[model samples]
Target: MSRVVFTLALAASGLLAQAPTPGPLVRLYPVALDANGQPVTDLTADDFKIVDQTKPQTILAFHKPRNEPAAPHEVLEFSNRTSGVTPHATVILFDMINLLDADRLANWKALDKALPQLESGESVYFYVLNLEGALLPIHAISPPAAGDKTWPQGVATGFDKVMKASSHIRQAQIGAEEQVKRTFKALEDLANKLAAFPGRRDILWVANGLTTVPDPMLPHCNGDWVECSLYVPHLGVTLAKDRVAVDPYALVGNISPDVNYNMDQMALLTGGHFYSRQDVRAVVNQVTQGAVGGYSIFYDPGPDNWNNKWHRVHVTCERKGVKLQLRERYYALPDSRPAVERMKAVLMEAFQNPTDLAEIGVRTKISPLPDGKPGVHLDIRIDPSDLLLREQGGKYSGALYCLVSDRSATAPLGEPSVLDLKPELTAEQYKMVMKNGLPFMQDHPTSDTAREVRVIILDQNTNAVGSVTFSVK
Candidate 1:
């Protein structure tokens, strides 16, 4: 519930995705106010500045303080794709992965009590980190009335519910290896979920905030490892293989590091707010009441079809003396290149198998199926083949993995399809010879017919060698 304002030295690049014509660019106004937690309705548009990087961009439009009942703010816009759904989405990540502090712990309890009282009009997704440190969508709620279908009272509240969920998960009682996959899959589900929604949305992340983990310098490991924790006291860190060992009373938040980048980028690019894990009371109050009645700025950088690049956006107050708060920036839709280009540029460096796969090839498909919902339907299939391992002498041996990345610009999205290709073969490879792959529901296909999907692939060692943009659309 705490607020964080990051003022960065801007850098310039022509990396923005091609945006649709100027209209209503989803804008989140960070209303700065006095310490009393009241809206400073006196501020006007003249008190704000919009900057892309260091260079200030003109604020195309602005609005004064408005309430929820003041006519639902015309924020929704349509995209030009086959379906007119806007590609905007956001998430509020409740980072409870390693909170061990008593005070912050109390804050979390306070939040639980406040959630029912909080009010919001838009549909935002709630994601939490399991004991294993994997992010998962616990539930997606639409403001006040549309609470969780299962638990109409709403998601769990209090330390017991949160800790119990973590304990059960840690004991391998639930969500095992799938925990890691959830880190990526949660995003994918969110993106697809957003696609199902009508307009653009932003993710608002709330946590005990971020801090550092225990380092070897501590009496425990003796310089062998580092400590990881959250931004506030009373918040503890969750260890992968051990129970709580570190004390939260001994830690404090640092600015240089401790901030979670993965969570940051996920929300930033999609036009979401990354609420720091500070002042639990303030954070809870902020989330309950939408924005603080600040300046709502909007811009249309021009149809963003390419869903692949990290675009940087900045907002500055044109008026001096008045402080301005906004998300660090936003990432644009990805580049429109075939899968190969994306792998070479982004995926290859991280995904290669250790042994020595010199090159890799990828294929993808999306199958549509009938669903109760009305929207694009998809059953995604990714095939990774033609892997060449690094040759040691005359013998070629190594493990290869094929990963399918499902990410969309519209939602808090991600899903990774990893295929272990240790034994490679041709289309006539062997008995049952189906391509080793993973299938996921991409979009709920209109009919029962699935659509062929296109995916970018990466080799363990080499960059992108080839891509399969196959489709049944």
Candidate 2:
């Protein structure tokens, strides 16, 4: 029988079962600094007030100067040292469908310079917001260099195609307004991706600024594009059909003369800054400071989410002489779904389309082969573990699949293998096995001691969802 069939049979026989309790909430603090390049480390809880809408709320946990590295226990075995709470992971947001030639080059130069200095812990992901949909990673690149020489050339080509396509559509007026709406809708999709990630993530959004399509028949009197670009796109349009006009200037307004106003607003709320000038180094510096200075604060609103709405946050300096400016606010909506459901959403995104996952977990266990060759088995674990799909009724029905990837430069120890996890196994169980049961290469006796190995998981037959990386030395 095929592996999928075999796994399913195993599940039916009750060989696997779910685990109790959900995973712990992973929280990281992001600090945002101002122009003077000072870290806002002295604020107290009372000095900062969180407001969901206009009402006041409590602050659950707060930390200042939260740039310290996670405790050793908190660090992943494969974690990069530089990956701590430092504003190291940089996201390059390029809007091909909406950006002009000048804007495009400006973005490229900034990314090129920024990609190199990323510490081992620091990560970089590139995205392009256009009508083709939110452009996720076409390929994953590791540190030392996130892109090959040819990668930039390829990205430039994609940008050209999107621009060309936009020009073609701009020429057709049968739905001129509609076409623009679709394009902005694509940008909003990009926003959703950003919001889903941990708050205070750094994103360099390079675009022509945000524009709201005109409509004057809605309460709160805001335009649809702003809501879509700011909150949720579909809901934004449904409630904003008669709200506003497409005024790009008002949407982003002076943050970055070049970036879309709506896009900039979203970035600001997420604790990221916008850049428009072409001074590549300067822009990079700004992004670095923005990411480093901003911090993410999380709190539980006492479970009284009776009327789900957006909650606002305001941070003030407790010290008398210091001035505090934070990304204006965040919407506190009720997340009724269990953490597992949320994990699944992220897994689907990482493993399927929109490769936004910045980190993955891989567990390995080591054993000796009959011939005394060191053999290692690895399991890559991801949250919302249901992604590892199993076959049912002769069709693919599982959500996740595991594959072993070999990056070994030398020797023939053995090829990697994919582990077909039984569907009945819970995500937590998968994680435990992957985390603690993974083989340790040191315990294995192998002639080929110099090789790199990775356990990679896939979702929907696309994108690498989770990966465990190690080298046999």
Candidate 3:
């Protein structure tokens, strides 16, 4: 069988058979900064007051956001690092899709001068959104090899080649209204990739102007420019779901304040700042500050609060002149069938997609089964903290849905096999789980011809995902 679904008849694991519990407790990551824009490192849970729909809710828990590297995992291991609560990442998207010729030149020349000066190993990323509205990576999210040029050096030396190649791939210009739609779509897709990773994600959206994102709808809104953007609430929810903050930076100097009101609103709505004018170095500085130096606070929105509406969220800090940035709004509606269908689509896509998602950190071990069947035994350990657990009665309850695909089977696959992991933990069990990791062990039958096995795991509460692909030895 070529490309069959891996059966998840889990080998009698303790928690795999339990019924899944209802999800509770929403989490938010908000950035706290001083008047001079420096991070406030010492803020505690008592220092914050979270409001939902004009009602003040008590802060249940909070943690200062930091990049804590994980302890070593097993060999041949792949980790998404969701469990460690990795520090924020910054993506610098040079928006050639919207910039004019003159502005594009000025934008890149500034980049050419400032890129090489970035500290050698900062977590800042670089990409170019081409005229076709397709995203191309200028610098991948990996360390450079020894004796190899860094991305900054590469950009400084060969910036023209990058720009030319991106332009050469352009098709017929997508119309103004379509440009707006596509731009938002591309941004949402980008956010989904970052969703699997925890902590804040800062996107430095570099464009001189993006007035076309809603060209057709703009004329109908009278003078309430931001009202149209508000109705397009899915974009805001997607950013918030992924814990992403958008920092809109002007591509060229002296941009008129009236040019891109929507982006400025986006910056505020997502807890990121809008840059009116800045050189290349300043852009890096702003993005780094926005990403790493921040805080993550979680609050219980009460049982009656999830009433499927667009709820406004605001955070207030007790310290004077300490500005707070967070996603101000989110749609409370949780889709029914679409979510299941979406994960299935993603599982199918994982076989060919180059990158594996890390929002839900996952580590797995594969070994040969001792039985006569020519299959492999799978052992999975997930970062327990990444699961959305709620304490009810005397137990902590949460669940995970796992999907696996294998092309190396003898029979054609049927509807995908879903593995449900609803762990039931008492106080002692929960403590043990926190000390060790969450484990899911199963024996999966594989064909001798099996080449690769792809697994996708997701938290049912938030739909945060992590995936890994391992070769059959």
lDDT of each: 0.36, 0.41, 0.65
For candidate 2, the 10 contiguous residues with the lowest summed lDDT are 242-251
Question: What is the C-alpha lDDT profile of model 2 across 1-473, one tens digit per residue?
Answer: 11322121123422112212132221224443444756665455576555544556555334444355543422234521224454243455565545554455554455445444433223445555544444545323234343343344345455455545554543333244554565556544444444333214344555564444544333464433433333344433321221111112111213453344565555434444444444543454555554445543544444564233433445554455554444454333445765444434543343332222333334343333555456553323343321323334443333344544344453223433334443433555445543443222222232454465554554432222454445655
Per lDDT, the best of the predicted structures is 3
TM-score quality measure for candidate 1: 0.38
> Over the stretch 96-151, how does candidate 3's per-residue lDDT look in tens digits?
86677778778877767777877653556677778777777766544232123355
Q: What TM-score goes with each of the models?
A: 0.38, 0.50, 0.71
Candidate RMSDs in order: 19.6, 11.8, 6.2
lDDT of 2 at 444: 27
Per-residue C-alpha lDDT of model 1 across residues 1-473, encoded as one tens digit per residue: 11111111111211111111122233444545545545565576576656553455554444454333211112221111112111122354454543434444564565565445434423434566555656555555333323332331365553346656665653343333343343334334444333322223333444433333442224443321111211111111111001111101112233223335534533333333345544433443453333434444554443442233323456655544554444444334333553333333334432222111112222223333455453333333222222323344544433433443322322112333433334443333332333343233334222223233223344333232333333333
Between candidates 1 and 2, the lDDT winner: 2
